[model samples]
Target chain A: MLGIDDPLIWGVYILCILSMILCVVYGLINWNRGEEAEVQEIAEEEAWEEEEEKMQSEELGL
Target chain B: MDLMILNLVILVYLLATLYLGYRGWKATKDSEGYMVAGRKTHPYIMAMSYGATFISTSAIVGFGGTAAKFGMGLLWLTFLNIFVGIFIAFVIYGKATRKMGHNLNAMTFPELLGRRFESRFIQVASGLVIFLGMPLYASVVLIGAARFLETTLAINFDLALLVYSVIIAAYVIWGGLRGVMYTDAMQGTIMFLGMAVLLFETYSRLGGVTLAHQALTNMAPLVPADLAAMGHTGWTSMPVLGSPWWWTLVSTIVLGVGIGVLAMPQLVVRFMTVKSNRELNRGVLVGGIFILMMTGVAFAVGALSNVFFLNTRGMIATAVESNVDSIIPVYINATMPEWFIYVFMLTLLAAAMSTSSSQFHTQGTAIGRDIYETLTGQKGGRSILLTRIGVSTAVIMAVILGYYLPGNVIARGTAVFFGLCAAAFLPMYTLGLFWRRTTRAGASAGLIGGTLVTVFMYLFVHKAESAPLGIAKMVLGRDVLITQMPWPVVDPMLIALPISLVLTVLVSLITRPPPERHLDLCFRGMKKG
Candidate 1:
């Protein structure tokens, strides 16, 4: 039987598991962030447009 | 087994690769398209191309051969491959690279550095270094690929090298980056499948994974006297903590390649091929899984090869031919099911071609566009012609080098290149991307100082394989210059990396900071220039 007590074997297993978990989490978070940024981009564009309209009306004395 | 079936398979694979090259050529309309795949490559293609290019025949054939001698302790390299090569490369360095590259309108790696520091001299010098140094690395990959053919088919080594070089060069010269990436995706798939099958087959043949490990552990007492003298205890366990074998395993192979991926010009260029950070994010899982399969399988199977060899031939791996490099090839020839041989041969070809094409493309762009065009201020048709010439020239140089390299030198040769890159380029690369205050002078010093120190150490201090014209032997009547050092076998990277890192940080602190606009352009958030 193989020695289950060997640290080298366990070290490799743990590191591989950790790497997989990190990649999964990183991918999910970044994918969601990409979506959140798109929504924020639209919101920022609307706010800019509203500010631009207010300035135009005031300039024309509307 | 019939040669006709193998020939047909080879012909079909070549034709498909050439067709992809033709497609890439048709799609190209300008220098930008040729250089960076028009910067709109899909995530799957990007990830596959990156993984394939990153894990070459060197990783498979060379490292696999090493594992046959060294055992499963080599698996730590697999973890590093995933964590550093994929995770850090894509997550940590990927975004900044894409953003800064786009901001500077830089296509080549050297060009990106040049624009960041506002120095044409930096660009030209980097290109020269890459052109000169990369061939040595590429030649090892060539040898790894051709050695498979030589062992399997009894073909002449020179002929095998020449044929593979010509086929890869044709597509690279014709299609540019697009052709290279397109074919890399296809090649990457074959490699993934081949390794997965080999892993399962090896375990099944050995009865099971646990039994294989136990058997290998039982063979500890059988370790060669020479190897045991170097502190090797067994194939399953790590060598004695401070032994020369331990140091080489930990420093040269593990740490060297683990850190070196961050700075590789060929691999780094892959980041700029995508359109958005999301593409990089998308690549993470695919790349991770691909690496886990390719390297994890290779290491496991390579180590288990001892079981198969001892069972069948009653000989240990090194005893087969007295060459560690031949062990893997001999194992496959002896034990693999006959039907899988041709398919596996294609897998090796895939691994070799994907990496060689990328190397040739990177070398070509560095010379033709980065150095020649940057120096002469040339663009358009003339620049493309020069890049084609550069690709051809790199192929010739690599082929020549492959001819002369000693047997079993593939893994050692690869370590030399990887260690050199980590020592020479990693400090500058890391600070360049993240540290805004890094000045051109500091960067230049780090580049020159780090590379020269690495070369010097390899020649004078580290005497594992080959050194610079036997300088130490002639001068000191010893193979190594520094015999009294605490860690006699510590890799050059362990010494040279610290020197490079200190020089970069010390110089940057003392020198003038970069121009404000330059800093903003490189680091300022999310504004696609």
Candidate 2:
């Protein structure tokens, strides 16, 4: 198809481009899907960070 | 090349890199920030860092040279790199890893595995493996870049090695992961642009894509007699099926590095850097395109370099340079303009630095967090300070090895690390994430057993590594334990990974499952609720 005789060679060559396009479409579709969950997760993450900090300081006898 | 012009360009680039490093240092507030960029990195930064760290100078110059010799068959590796390395990795593995790493507050790849299975032994052992094995890989990368500078700028090799190591060590030690990622993003952009231009120029010069490929295909009869004996068919075709060349291409290069990317410690930690699945989703787009441009173009241009050489020099690329490693560089010097040479130099510099920076970071964390803290039972604020010290130590070790190690080790160093990571880590890592029933005993057995098997194969069975290493020759009086044709050529990862996977599953079935409460904690928020 791309002037190469072997199907396997040209097959993978085309698959590389197709796989990249798949990534683009997947990204655009899922860009905004999990945003709300991220906000709540951030709050939990902050709490965990504070806990981690406290533990480290305690170990240091601060 | 104009020395003054090149120096000005490099000076400006280094200054910009230092500025980004300064920004990372200013932003780092705690150990978490140093380790995982505080788990709030922008999707673009995370994706670029991951891609840049994955595609090194070896991938471009080394593997690209192999493509030039072997033909377009190496494109299969590029396909696997994008589809598996980016798409499946970000979608399937990244989400699970990020959630679990957050739940466990895991800071490094080893720590992620350690906390998951509740096995300090696993963490410390994995850390030791990385600390010991990674220096060779890092040193090889260091040597590749230093050699380029030495040849291009007429600098002394020793001075180039010292200066390059010091530049990378400065930023990585001070700013940590944030510094690494920011620099990686900028470097990745340069790599993308460089490869894009090379591909465009090659195709246009060769009368577009189809004609260039057709020209190479028609030149099939010109295949050297020696290469044809080993299964060289044509530039646009796969090697003759079931031949020695086909096995090396399919088993070693394509499958070895292809599936091995899943288990690389430096790359796996990148999954933990982003905020959520949304960031990973966005990262997929950037990472896919970045890898496509980086490796896809390198492989394509590499094979097409034959066409360019034929038109200009009336000989094939291999005829021009007996050493395949020099094919890309020699081709560029012969064909590209002066300005493009400067740009390509930066591209090679960026590729080397980005990969080396990540290696140093991962090695340092392996020593500080995985080995030191786990062994000594110390988790105080001092560990981050120790990690910086570790980073410095890693840089010094790599520099020393670059000076000492023989030149031939560079090609084998990368494959050894990748094969080791796959056999040692992949089975346990994959099962630990998805199977709540995976036991600590099973994980441990897989980890240790897989490592031993891979080492044994390298020492005895794999002719490519063993013949050069010569441990088998000294001790056992054989170049390779098996002199059989295909058996000697098969990669250790192909043998060890399946054994490791079965060992994990069977042992887990026989042993007690991990605590349910811990399993719940690890798996929490992994699925979209």
Best by TM-score: 2
Candidate 2 TM-score to native? 0.91
Docking quality level of the chain pair in candidate 2? acceptable
Q: What are the clashing pairs of model 1?
A: none
Top candidate (DockQ): 2
- Over B1-529, each residue of candidate 2 has an lDDT whose tens digit, in order, gives 7877778787888898789766655565544533245556677887888888888877887777778888899999999999999998999988888788888888689999999989999999999888888888888888777766665666787898888788777646444444356777888888888888889999999999899899989889988999999898988899888788888888888888888889889888777756667788998999989999988998999899998898888888899877666677777766777766776777687778778878887887788789889988987566666666677788899999989866534445677788889999999999999888889999999999889999999999988888888999998899899888888888898999998888998999999888888888888877522
* Candidate with the greatest lDDT versus the true structure: 2
Task: Assess candidate 1 and give its lDDT.
Answer: 0.77
Which pairs clash in the backbone of model 2?
A: none
TM-score of each: 0.89, 0.91
